[model samples]
Target: MALFSARRGSGLAAWLLAGSLACLLLVLVDASRMAEERTRERAHGRALVARVGLTDLALFNEARYTRHLSQADRHAAFQDHPGALEHFPAGSLAGPARPSP
Candidate 1:
Protein backbone atom coordinates (compact mmCIF):
# COMPACT_ATOMS: atom_id res chain seq x y z
CA MET A 1 0.00 0.00 0.00
CA ALA A 2 3.10 2.31 0.19
CA LEU A 3 2.90 3.03 -3.57
CA PHE A 4 -0.80 4.02 -3.22
CA SER A 5 -0.10 6.16 -0.12
CA ALA A 6 2.54 8.16 -2.04
CA ARG A 7 -0.09 9.16 -4.66
CA ARG A 8 -2.77 9.98 -2.01
CA GLY A 9 -1.26 13.41 -1.14
CA SER A 10 -1.06 14.44 -4.82
CA GLY A 11 -4.66 13.26 -5.30
CA LEU A 12 -5.86 15.48 -2.43
CA ALA A 13 -3.93 18.51 -3.78
CA ALA A 14 -5.41 17.99 -7.27
CA TRP A 15 -8.95 17.85 -5.83
CA LEU A 16 -8.37 21.02 -3.79
CA LEU A 17 -7.08 22.88 -6.87
CA ALA A 18 -10.06 21.69 -8.92
CA GLY A 19 -12.52 22.81 -6.20
CA SER A 20 -10.83 26.24 -5.97
CA LEU A 21 -11.06 26.67 -9.73
CA ALA A 22 -14.75 25.75 -9.64
CA CYS A 23 -15.38 28.36 -6.96
CA LEU A 24 -13.51 30.98 -8.98
CA LEU A 25 -15.58 30.18 -12.06
CA LEU A 26 -18.78 30.56 -10.02
CA VAL A 27 -17.60 33.99 -8.79
CA LEU A 28 -16.81 35.09 -12.35
CA VAL A 29 -20.27 34.03 -13.53
CA ASP A 30 -21.94 35.93 -10.66
CA ALA A 31 -19.86 39.06 -11.37
CA SER A 32 -20.89 38.97 -15.03
CA ARG A 33 -24.56 38.79 -14.02
CA MET A 34 -24.12 41.69 -11.56
CA ALA A 35 -22.41 43.76 -14.27
CA GLU A 36 -25.55 43.67 -16.41
CA GLU A 37 -27.73 44.66 -13.42
CA ARG A 38 -25.31 47.47 -12.54
CA THR A 39 -25.65 49.01 -16.02
CA ARG A 40 -29.44 49.21 -15.66
CA GLU A 41 -29.14 50.62 -12.12
CA ARG A 42 -26.71 53.30 -13.36
CA ALA A 43 -29.20 54.50 -15.94
CA HIS A 44 -31.95 54.64 -13.31
CA GLY A 45 -29.69 56.62 -10.97
CA ARG A 46 -28.87 59.15 -13.72
CA ALA A 47 -32.57 59.70 -14.36
CA LEU A 48 -33.23 60.27 -10.65
CA VAL A 49 -30.35 62.72 -10.40
CA ALA A 50 -31.61 64.71 -13.35
CA ARG A 51 -35.20 64.80 -12.03
CA VAL A 52 -34.16 65.73 -8.47
CA GLY A 53 -31.83 68.55 -9.56
CA LEU A 54 -28.27 69.03 -8.23
CA THR A 55 -28.05 68.62 -4.48
CA ASP A 56 -25.34 67.56 -2.03
CA LEU A 57 -25.64 63.86 -1.15
CA ALA A 58 -26.17 63.31 2.55
CA LEU A 59 -23.43 61.06 3.90
CA PHE A 60 -24.40 60.66 7.54
CA ASN A 61 -27.97 60.58 8.88
CA GLU A 62 -26.89 60.44 12.51
CA ALA A 63 -26.89 64.22 13.03
CA ARG A 64 -28.17 67.35 11.25
CA TYR A 65 -24.72 68.95 11.36
CA THR A 66 -23.20 66.04 9.51
CA ARG A 67 -26.11 65.77 7.06
CA HIS A 68 -24.83 68.68 4.97
CA LEU A 69 -21.27 69.62 5.84
CA SER A 70 -20.95 72.22 3.09
CA GLN A 71 -24.03 74.09 4.31
CA ALA A 72 -23.49 73.34 8.01
CA ASP A 73 -23.23 76.29 10.42
CA ARG A 74 -19.92 76.18 12.27
CA HIS A 75 -21.59 77.33 15.48
CA ALA A 76 -24.48 74.86 15.09
CA ALA A 77 -22.56 72.17 16.96
CA PHE A 78 -22.75 74.35 20.09
CA GLN A 79 -26.50 74.85 19.80
CA ASP A 80 -27.02 73.07 23.10
CA HIS A 81 -24.34 75.05 24.89
CA PRO A 82 -20.97 76.73 24.22
CA GLY A 83 -18.89 73.86 25.68
CA ALA A 84 -20.96 70.89 24.56
CA LEU A 85 -19.01 67.83 23.46
CA GLU A 86 -19.93 66.06 20.20
CA HIS A 87 -22.67 63.57 21.13
CA PHE A 88 -23.32 62.00 17.73
CA PRO A 89 -20.90 59.28 16.54
CA ALA A 90 -20.89 60.77 13.03
CA GLY A 91 -19.79 64.18 14.36
CA SER A 92 -16.24 62.91 14.90
CA LEU A 93 -16.03 61.60 11.35
CA ALA A 94 -16.44 65.10 9.89
CA GLY A 95 -13.76 67.77 10.11
CA PRO A 96 -14.35 71.39 11.17
CA ALA A 97 -16.43 73.29 8.59
CA ARG A 98 -14.60 75.67 6.32
CA PRO A 99 -15.17 79.36 6.97
CA SER A 100 -17.04 81.23 4.27
CA PRO A 101 -15.07 84.04 2.57
Candidate 2:
Protein backbone atom coordinates (compact mmCIF):
# COMPACT_ATOMS: atom_id res chain seq x y z
CA MET A 1 0.00 0.00 0.00
CA ALA A 2 3.05 2.27 0.38
CA LEU A 3 3.68 2.14 -3.38
CA PHE A 4 0.09 3.18 -4.09
CA SER A 5 0.26 5.92 -1.45
CA ALA A 6 3.50 7.26 -2.95
CA ARG A 7 1.89 7.26 -6.42
CA ARG A 8 -1.03 9.28 -5.05
CA GLY A 9 1.22 12.23 -4.04
CA SER A 10 1.13 12.22 -0.22
CA GLY A 11 -2.49 13.24 0.59
CA LEU A 12 -2.19 16.70 -0.96
CA ALA A 13 -5.40 16.18 -2.91
CA ALA A 14 -7.32 15.43 0.28
CA TRP A 15 -5.94 18.53 1.97
CA LEU A 16 -6.82 20.64 -1.04
CA LEU A 17 -10.37 19.30 -1.00
CA ALA A 18 -10.70 20.11 2.68
CA GLY A 19 -9.46 23.62 2.11
CA SER A 20 -11.91 24.11 -0.72
CA LEU A 21 -14.77 22.95 1.48
CA ALA A 22 -13.72 25.38 4.19
CA CYS A 23 -13.63 28.24 1.72
CA LEU A 24 -17.11 27.35 0.50
CA LEU A 25 -18.38 27.26 4.08
CA LEU A 26 -16.92 30.69 4.75
CA VAL A 27 -18.54 32.11 1.64
CA LEU A 28 -21.91 30.69 2.65
CA VAL A 29 -21.58 32.15 6.14
CA ASP A 30 -20.79 35.56 4.71
CA ALA A 31 -23.72 35.39 2.33
CA SER A 32 -26.09 34.47 5.15
CA ARG A 33 -24.83 37.38 7.22
CA MET A 34 -25.44 39.77 4.33
CA ALA A 35 -28.95 38.40 3.85
CA GLU A 36 -29.68 38.83 7.57
CA GLU A 37 -28.55 42.44 7.41
CA ARG A 38 -30.78 43.11 4.40
CA THR A 39 -33.73 41.53 6.20
CA ARG A 40 -33.21 43.74 9.23
CA GLU A 41 -32.99 46.79 7.02
CA ARG A 42 -36.24 45.86 5.32
CA ALA A 43 -37.95 45.32 8.66
CA HIS A 44 -36.79 48.68 9.95
CA GLY A 45 -38.04 50.36 6.80
CA ARG A 46 -41.41 48.66 7.20
CA ALA A 47 -41.67 49.73 10.81
CA LEU A 48 -41.01 53.35 9.91
CA VAL A 49 -43.60 53.22 7.15
CA ALA A 50 -46.15 51.70 9.53
CA ARG A 51 -45.41 54.24 12.24
CA VAL A 52 -46.02 57.04 9.74
CA GLY A 53 -49.19 55.33 8.45
CA LEU A 54 -48.21 55.17 4.81
CA THR A 55 -47.91 52.58 2.09
CA ASP A 56 -44.53 51.73 0.59
CA LEU A 57 -45.21 53.51 -2.71
CA ALA A 58 -46.56 56.55 -0.97
CA LEU A 59 -43.61 56.72 1.36
CA PHE A 60 -41.18 56.44 -1.50
CA ASN A 61 -42.88 59.23 -3.39
CA GLU A 62 -43.00 61.47 -0.37
CA ALA A 63 -39.36 60.89 0.41
CA ARG A 64 -38.39 61.66 -3.14
CA TYR A 65 -40.44 64.81 -3.09
CA THR A 66 -39.09 66.03 0.22
CA ARG A 67 -35.54 64.73 -0.11
CA HIS A 68 -34.21 67.97 -1.55
CA LEU A 69 -36.55 70.25 0.40
CA SER A 70 -35.49 71.70 3.73
CA GLN A 71 -37.85 72.06 6.68
CA ALA A 72 -38.17 75.73 5.96
CA ASP A 73 -38.77 75.04 2.30
CA ARG A 74 -41.44 72.53 3.17
CA HIS A 75 -42.99 75.00 5.57
CA ALA A 76 -43.04 77.62 2.85
CA ALA A 77 -44.54 75.16 0.36
CA PHE A 78 -47.43 74.55 2.77
CA GLN A 79 -47.68 77.97 4.34
CA ASP A 80 -49.19 79.46 1.22
CA HIS A 81 -51.95 76.82 1.13
CA PRO A 82 -53.12 76.12 4.64
CA GLY A 83 -55.00 72.81 5.05
CA ALA A 84 -54.86 72.15 1.33
CA LEU A 85 -55.35 68.63 0.02
CA GLU A 86 -52.56 69.12 -2.51
CA HIS A 87 -50.16 70.20 0.20
CA PHE A 88 -50.76 67.08 2.25
CA PRO A 89 -48.56 64.04 1.70
CA ALA A 90 -50.31 61.29 -0.22
CA GLY A 91 -50.07 58.65 2.50
CA SER A 92 -50.32 60.93 5.54
CA LEU A 93 -54.08 61.02 5.23
CA ALA A 94 -56.26 57.92 5.43
CA GLY A 95 -57.29 56.78 1.99
CA PRO A 96 -57.80 53.65 -0.06
CA ALA A 97 -54.63 51.78 -0.96
CA ARG A 98 -56.05 51.21 -4.38
CA PRO A 99 -58.21 53.37 -6.58
CA SER A 100 -61.90 52.63 -6.17
CA PRO A 101 -64.76 53.34 -8.49
Candidate 3:
Protein backbone atom coordinates (compact mmCIF):
# COMPACT_ATOMS: atom_id res chain seq x y z
CA MET A 1 0.00 0.00 0.00
CA ALA A 2 2.83 2.41 0.76
CA LEU A 3 4.54 1.73 -2.56
CA PHE A 4 1.32 2.24 -4.44
CA SER A 5 0.69 5.59 -2.76
CA ALA A 6 4.22 6.79 -3.57
CA ARG A 7 3.81 5.82 -7.23
CA ARG A 8 0.47 7.58 -7.40
CA GLY A 9 1.93 10.81 -5.93
CA SER A 10 4.80 10.76 -8.46
CA GLY A 11 2.33 10.34 -11.32
CA LEU A 12 0.24 13.25 -10.12
CA ALA A 13 3.31 15.45 -9.77
CA ALA A 14 4.44 14.62 -13.29
CA TRP A 15 1.03 15.47 -14.67
CA LEU A 16 0.99 18.82 -12.86
CA LEU A 17 4.46 19.67 -14.11
CA ALA A 18 3.50 18.88 -17.69
CA GLY A 19 0.33 20.99 -17.43
CA SER A 20 2.29 23.96 -16.07
CA LEU A 21 4.85 23.73 -18.83
CA ALA A 22 2.12 23.55 -21.46
CA CYS A 23 0.48 26.64 -20.04
CA LEU A 24 3.73 28.54 -20.11
CA LEU A 25 4.34 27.53 -23.72
CA LEU A 26 0.86 28.66 -24.67
CA VAL A 27 1.38 32.02 -23.04
CA LEU A 28 4.67 32.51 -24.80
CA VAL A 29 3.11 31.63 -28.16
CA ASP A 30 0.29 34.09 -27.58
CA ALA A 31 2.73 36.85 -26.72
CA SER A 32 4.75 36.18 -29.82
CA ARG A 33 1.63 36.29 -31.98
CA MET A 34 0.59 39.58 -30.45
CA ALA A 35 4.00 41.06 -31.14
CA GLU A 36 3.83 39.95 -34.77
CA GLU A 37 0.33 41.39 -35.15
CA ARG A 38 1.43 44.71 -33.75
CA THR A 39 4.35 44.83 -36.14
CA ARG A 40 2.13 44.13 -39.13
CA GLU A 41 -0.37 46.74 -38.02
CA ARG A 42 2.35 49.34 -37.73
CA ALA A 43 3.63 48.49 -41.19
CA HIS A 44 0.14 48.77 -42.63
CA GLY A 45 -0.33 52.15 -40.97
CA ARG A 46 2.92 53.44 -42.44
CA ALA A 47 1.92 52.22 -45.90
CA LEU A 48 -1.40 54.02 -45.61
CA VAL A 49 0.29 57.24 -44.54
CA ALA A 50 2.72 57.01 -47.40
CA ARG A 51 -0.09 56.44 -49.87
CA VAL A 52 -2.05 59.42 -48.61
CA GLY A 53 1.00 61.64 -48.62
CA LEU A 54 1.80 60.72 -52.21
CA THR A 55 -1.75 61.32 -53.33
CA ASP A 56 -1.91 64.67 -51.59
CA LEU A 57 1.38 65.69 -53.08
CA ALA A 58 0.23 64.74 -56.55
CA LEU A 59 -3.01 66.65 -56.25
CA PHE A 60 -1.24 69.68 -54.93
CA ASN A 61 1.21 69.55 -57.79
CA GLU A 62 -1.60 69.37 -60.31
CA ALA A 63 -3.28 72.39 -58.77
CA ARG A 64 -0.02 74.31 -58.74
CA TYR A 65 0.58 73.48 -62.38
CA THR A 66 -2.84 74.72 -63.31
CA ARG A 67 -2.01 77.99 -61.57
CA HIS A 68 1.29 78.27 -63.50
CA LEU A 69 3.60 77.73 -60.51
CA SER A 70 7.06 76.25 -61.00
CA GLN A 71 7.95 72.81 -59.57
CA ALA A 72 9.95 74.32 -56.72
CA ASP A 73 7.13 76.73 -55.89
CA ARG A 74 4.62 73.89 -55.91
CA HIS A 75 6.77 71.89 -53.49
CA ALA A 76 6.97 74.88 -51.20
CA ALA A 77 3.25 75.46 -51.42
CA PHE A 78 2.47 71.90 -50.37
CA GLN A 79 4.74 72.19 -47.36
CA ASP A 80 3.15 75.47 -46.42
CA HIS A 81 -0.35 74.03 -46.50
CA PRO A 82 -1.75 73.72 -42.96
CA GLY A 83 -3.80 70.60 -43.69
CA ALA A 84 -0.82 68.74 -45.12
CA LEU A 85 1.38 69.63 -42.18
CA GLU A 86 -1.23 68.31 -39.73
CA HIS A 87 -1.49 64.85 -41.27
CA PHE A 88 0.81 63.41 -38.64
CA PRO A 89 1.49 64.50 -35.11
CA ALA A 90 4.31 66.90 -34.26
CA GLY A 91 6.58 64.18 -32.87
CA SER A 92 4.35 61.20 -32.04
CA LEU A 93 2.64 58.33 -33.82
CA ALA A 94 -0.77 59.77 -33.12
CA GLY A 95 -2.84 61.16 -36.00
CA PRO A 96 -4.07 64.74 -36.38
CA ALA A 97 -6.43 66.83 -34.16
CA ARG A 98 -3.82 67.51 -31.49
CA PRO A 99 -4.75 70.38 -29.19
CA SER A 100 -2.73 73.53 -29.47
CA PRO A 101 -0.77 74.75 -26.49
Task: Name the candidate that leads on lDDT.
Answer: 1
What's the number of clashes in each of the models? 0, 0, 0
- Tens digits of per-residue lDDT for model 3, 1-101: 45334368786777788789999999998998999999988897679868775332222323343223322333333354523542222212212233449
- Candidate 3 segments whose C-alpha is farther than 4 A from its true place: 1-7, 44-101
**Would you list the C-alpha lDDT of every candidate in the order shown?**
0.71, 0.55, 0.52
User: Which sections of candidate 1 miss by over 4 Å?
Assistant: 1-7, 69-86, 92-101
Once superposed on the true structure, which residue ranges of model 2 sit more than 4 Å away at CA? 1-10, 44-101
If ranked by TM-score, best first, what sequence of candidates would result?
1, 3, 2
lDDT of 3 at 99: 41
| Cα-lDDT of candidate 3 | 0.52
lDDT of 2: 0.55
Q: What does candidate 2's lDDT look like per residue over 1-101, in tens digits?
A: 45335347656666677789999999998998999999989998799878987543533245443433322234333444544344446424522222237
lDDT of 2 at 61: 41
TM-score list, all predictions: 0.57, 0.34, 0.34
Candidate 3: residue pairs that collide:
none
